[model samples]
Target: MSMTANTAMAASTPRRGSSIAWSDVLLNIYILIFFLYLFVPLLIMIGAAFNVNSTPSITDWQGFTLDWFTGEVDEETGRVIAKGLPQEDRFLQGLWHSVIIALGVVAIAIPLGLSGALVLTRLQSGSTTFLYTLLISPILTPGIVLGVTTMIFWRDIFSVEAGLFTTMIAHSTFIASYCMLMFMARLQRQDRGLEEAALDLGASNVMVFRRITLPFLRPTILTAAVIGFLQSMENYNTTFFAIGGSWTLVTEIGSRMRFGLTPVINAIGVIFIVITVVAAVAWVFFRKREKG
Candidate 1:
């Protein structure tokens, strides 16, 4: 009887394995379809950047040209235009402005976010929930509403001018929440004993924080800084309101789009996409090396 029962179990195992294999195959096919759906638009955009013609339609394959990268001149007006390519000083200036603003936002947001996360983590009361909601409220708010509110609050109430500083502050308001949330999540899983051990080893509070807490938080800090920088750079709605006629890369792109779409924008997109892909690849390698 025992041998018969064992034989029956063995016989059923292959059927169960077959069912799981079929399910996995179907799931992999769905995932592949989903990835292709997401990737096709980006591939089309990158391909279109290399096309000689700037038409939105992707049916025709114009011979590859680099005119979109090399600057062009307006024949009738004799004015230098962003028509053929996007290498003008203005675009460079706009990119520089974005970089500066992103740096400023990171500088202000990181410390504030770290402190906020620390406070929220230490608190153990009902009010902590309210504070969490308050910190994250900006993320839920519409960008346009945030922009308008920022403009009114700064310009009318504080009598501040719209410029780089205002834009940085506006961006930091929401971005800090993202940083705080990332840190808070990391902190939740962190072991407190390491910090306590450092304190017990005759280390001063500042020394303990510098050597122990900061090192542990380095990954989170780097993640937050990168996230904040990217958010500030690509932000359009809040920056648009706070810029007060000041130009940044995103705004410049919007302005150029009003005249006509150009492949130059695609060139810029391609540059950024390449940078992002390279950075991600490097990060994966670095992580693997650390594990090894």
Candidate 2:
């Protein structure tokens, strides 16, 4: 009887294994297709960047040239001129401007977001709901509307020039809302007992926060900061309205597209992709190390 039962169990095990294998195969195929759909355009763009002759015509392959990285072609003279034309550094300058603005946004957003999140966490039922709605309202507001309102507000109230400063403020207003939301969500899952115990042990409010809350919230804060920075850097609609005459990497690329598309843009895109991928990989490895 025992031998017969063992044979039946062994036969059932093969069926279960086959089902799991089939599920895994289907899941892997789905993931492969999804990744292909997401990455194919980026792959094509990166490939085109290395093409010596990048043209407006996607179908027509001009023999590969590195001229776009080097210099611009003169339209009237029909000569490959290297002087008095915008080159790599011009694009880099715009990228630098974006970085500066993004950094500013992060600087302003993190403290405000963390404070707001902490306050909201302590609030009672009625005030909590109202505060939550107010905090999140900015994220829900349309970017175009926020940009226009910011432009109007700054112009009317402060009489400030519409430029990088205004653009940073505009981006920060909405991006900070997102940061607050991210931090608040993370804070909800946190153990507040450490904070209470620290306070009970006669620690000052500031000390309790510094020793217990801040360290605990550091990862969420960092995540929110990165998200805010990326949002500020890539923002177009708000930046467009608030930028006035100032140019950013996004604006420069958009403006230059009218004259002709160049491989330099692709080069820039590839660089961005590579940097982001490396950062993501490093983050994963660091996270694993921390867990270990």
Which candidate should be chosen as best, given TM-score against the real structure?
Answer: 1
C-alpha lDDT values of all predictions: 0.87, 0.80
Model 1, 47-95: lDDT tens per residue? 8888877774356877887677775667898776545544566688999
What TM-score would each prediction reach against the true structure?
Answer: 0.82, 0.79
lDDT (Cα, 0-100) at 85 in candidate 2? 20
TM-score of 1: 0.82
List the pairs of residues colliding in candidate 1: none
Judge candidate 2 at residue 231 and give its lDDT: 85
Predicted candidate 2 versus true structure: per-residue lDDT over 183-283, tens digit per residue: 88988998988888888889999998788888888888888888888888888888888888887888777777767886777766777799889989999
- Deviation in Å, model 1, residue 224 alpha carbon: 1.5
lDDT accuracy of residue 121 in candidate 1: 99
